[model samples]
Target: MALQDRPNEKPEASPADLVSSLAEASLALARAASEGEAYAALDMAAHRLAALSSGRVSICELGMSPNGRALILWQSSRGGLSIGEDSLFAEWYTRASRMGGEMTPARGHIWYGLLSADTLNDETGIRVAIFLKFDEMKEELAAHAYGLADIAAAVALRIRKQKAAALERRRFDGMYETTRAWLELGADIVWEASPEGILRCRRILNRRGDISRLVDGMDLRSLRIGGGGQSLLDFLEQQGSVRHMRAHLPEDAQGRMSTGETLYVSATARRSPDEDAPYIGTFTAIGRDAPSDGTRETATMLLQMRGARIREEQHRREAEAMLQGLRLLLSQDSSREKMSRLVGLVGECIGSSDACVAEKGLDGKVRILVPQQKSPGPGAAAALDFIAAGAPRGVVGVYDIDAAEGRNIADAFGLEGCQVAALALPLRGDAAFLVCVTRRAEGFAPADLDFADRFALLLRQALLLREEQSHLAQTAKMAALGQMSASIAHELRQPLNTISLAVQNLEFLLESLDFDREAAAKKTKRVLAQVERASDVIDRMRRFGRKSVGEHASLVLRNVIENVEAIMHHVLLRAGVRLEVEISPDVTAYADQLQLEQVIGNLLQNAVDAISGIGAKHERAEGLIKITASPSPDEKGMTVLRVEDSGPGFRPEIAERVLEPFFTTKSAEHGTGLGLAICDAIIRESGGRIEIGNHAAGGFVQIVLPRQPA
Candidate 1:
């Protein structure tokens, strides 16, 4: 090829030389390791091409300055074209306002072409300009110059890719180091294990001391849970993965177990996707050696706080479960039966075998209420007496039975030949009740003692509630009787009038001159019947007014309804309210007969009051009270008794509060409001519920009770 500056000069050597030089240059460019090395390779290639064509070559880096002017960053020294503080290239750049494409020759035999434009900058323009000085210009020389430019462009792209990859590699290395440091700070040991539970590698991060020396190749099956149970391998196989699992290592050569040193460890492991792949996990010591640095110390503190929170939550759940069991037992059992079972429940909670409730009489004699036929041993009896008489009420006391004072109690209780511990909690009352529990092993923990105290407190509350309910029931019954006073007198007057009339008729018969014996006999029979009728009314009132002794039995629903109706019949009549009963004769309910009657009567009275209240506001209002009993539709094996009244229904806002004590919408002089509250208490004690709402007809009160004893 001929040079553009020297057109008369023959092509350097031949086309064969051009191919050899281009191949060598391409290989050098491929071997370049960095952007600087790549540009050096290009510069060498430009020099070789210039030599082959008998011309001088200059490679200069051009870019737009911050002020929007083209400037030269660097240039080769072999070419005649000079780019300095004041150069021909700068003058040409100023005229053209650009730095790309071929530029016209400024002097003889000098040509310029863009080798690579904007190769480094997309936002700002940059270019590599090749300046060639040849003897003459020719089409062949121009082809060589453009070919070399294309090769340089390819090399520039390679350099850009290399720079990007190096930057990414540096970022990744920094991140990896940071993550490794954090892991080391957070854990005492990081480990990897085989699929078969063999430790492959373990890295200890603790700087102060190392408690675990179990090295690689150890079997996980050899390690047990800290408190003693299944092996670590067994746990891993069952659970597949574990987070913060605490385990104890085997005894070291020094004959020290994890527990003896008070060492606890938390482990977290994850299973790999492939079953045969290794597992990766960490082990952190809990409540042992302190960390060596502030960052690790903070991390350890966070872990301990989290563990404490989890343990607290677990304890709360256990307490709730125990309370629920206590509620169920109290609701279903009688007083005597409940006391016995309650002792048993306390014993189970405290892990004790012998437990009982002792009650002190006014004479200061302590007697066992639970385990009826069993009496406390002499020493135990003495302790119970002391507790009941002088021990602080509602406080749980623990004693080491192995001690001098407790040994006698233990021996007296027939708990010899073993360590024994006792816990006593006194319930509040004049006749104090003491709960006693004895364990044959170690002493009770603080948690166990706390649970026992809570149990005793709940038992006391239940007893108090029962006593209050009984008093309220009696009070409400007397109130009902008071309300029926006027009606009862009126009821008795009619029968008395009939008997008097019959006597008068008999006397008239006897005084007559023609006395008829049959008429006299008939009048005497009428008097006798009236007397019996009045007696029946008084007997019904006596039964209704009496206190209930919470004895549950399956009573015929119809019979119970009849008893209530008889008691409330005159009251309903006085209120001008109609009473309607709709109960199947075969339907039976398990509840205290007197209490059931009280509940029914109270509901009847409320209905009458509601209807009468409406009557006072509107004249001649038809008062209708209906009582219906049937099997409950929503609850299986339960009986439902509904009492509905034709009156204004309960207001939406106050409906839920109606059953609360002393919450009444009636005038204070008329309603003490214990009526519904007592009824609710009685029904609940019978393991039943009462619902009060407005039905389609009007206001309704429904009682649901078990058909059989629970």
Candidate 2:
């Protein structure tokens, strides 16, 4: 090798100089390696290389042996036509082949090969690649190439490490700053209290950040810990331990803790202390102290659920109390003693002053059995009392005691102040009765009302039963009166008729005597006819008012019209009226025979009265009374008795009230008011109907009775 071919060697270069130059280059490369740069950094390399190789650029790359690639090989390239294998690619390849290693056949001088983005040595941040050469001498390539590659990898690794270090510092600082702010705001504070049922307190912070005394005491997300507070020592109860005493405490949205006292902190989560993966934290804090924000959120959710359960429990208690009252009212019995006990029990249930019961009395006045309230009407003197009475008026009613002036009725009744709300129930018997209650301020809820209503219903049914019983007793009285009147009328009829015959005989015997005798005989005959008419009326009343035969029985009504006709005949004749009867002998009913005759007779009598009224007072007709009986067309073989009269006809109200007992427009002496009542009872007992209305011809009273079984 000619030294002159080395081209542009340093003018004063020497071996000593070369050592110094190499040393400089080595230092620069080392510096560049630390800074992480490659390839183009060789420009700096070349400047240093000039000290050794002068103007000639010498390069090296990895090489291969004759057998093929080897783990360690070297190659070099000479610039400016200074090599036997002159092409930069080929010459470098050959030089590498000559090294103590093997190389690939590409034979390139350029030191380039496939390189991976992944650092081949993660710890070193070094990326690995096959070392090929371009324009480099074969012999020394591996040595120089590796040195360059290693230096470059070192620089990249250093840069990556520096960046990571800066980021870690920032994150650590962030955690600390945020936690400090939270603590300053008193949003969170670590709590340390002993488990001795004692209240000793302290703020805690460990190596890993954790804070407590917050809205969510042990919650992770809500924990405002300094940078890294969670540590194992926290698990040993070095700070504080949970008290065994259990209690409910309000918690925030995180379910951790709230400002409310008396809350227990039991569960927890923490952050991992590993700095490399800073996102992780250690979770040493249990109840009052927890680190992670996520844990706080979860705790809050649980607290909300607990709160809902508590509310449900409270409602259940209220509902249960109300149901108990209702059950008590429904189970009691119905006598006054039983009733009194019931009212008292209910009053206690509702916390009331008094429960009073009153029944409307027989004389059309209200009476008080319980408490004995005095006097029937409003003029009565009493305190704290209520009244109930039967009237000619309408159905049931309710009145407020407070509105009644000055008498202190409310005070006496325990219903005066705010402590008094009262309810009165009308009894549902023959006549109405009342049950009044004056309650305390809590008043009565619907539950109370419902209970009272049920009790009232019971009393109502009982009262109605008693009334029915009394009505039954009255039936016998009615029957007795009817029988007495009928017998009197029957007895009176024969005597009166006998008297009339005697009077007629006397009139015949006295006709030629003085005018005074004729007048006396005529007047006597008139009196006899009046007596007969009165007797007939008595017969109808007696029969109509007779008591019911409770047992079902048969009756014969073929004689009803005949008997009724006899009663009416004298009246019709006196009134100058014509009476006719058209009825089947076979006509009968499942009725008391006397009752049937009364009904028939009453109809005939009513017709007679109407007809007599027409020509005399409201005057128009020479009246006719027609009685007819036949099988009713629509019934299953039933019978109908009809009495038609020529008269001014019937009034609406009169016809309406005709069947009501003790109701009549006639004078007291003239009627017991039982005529139509008795008639109705007779026909109704036979499962039949009695109707009075104006006929197309004039006035009418028709009775339709069911036929008796053959």
lDDT, each prediction = 0.64, 0.45
lDDT tens digits by residue: candidate 2, 41-84: 44344444444433344332222233322222222222321223
lDDT at 599, model 2:
58
Q: How well is each residue in 1-710 modelled by candidate 1, as lDDT tens digits?
A: 12223222234566677657756876787687776776777666665666666666666666555444456776654433344434445434432222124444532223444445332333123456666666765666666666665555555556766675677567655755644554544556666777777875455555523544643566778767645567777776776565655666666622543433333334435554575535655655545564423255545545665576567655754565465445534432334444555666666666676755555544555555456556657676576554444446655655566566556655544444333434344334425354444554656667766777667765665455555668778888888898788989999999999999999998899899998999898999999999999999999889888776555679999999888888888888888899888888999999889999988888888888888883224333688998888997746788999999988878776776787888887776678877887787787666666777787667899898878865
TM-score of each: 0.44, 0.29
Off by over 4 Å in 2: 1-546, 550-552, 566-576, 614-616, 651-665, 672-674, 708-710
Candidate 2 displacement at residue 81 in angstroms: 99
Winning candidate number (TM-score) = 1
lDDT of 1: 0.64
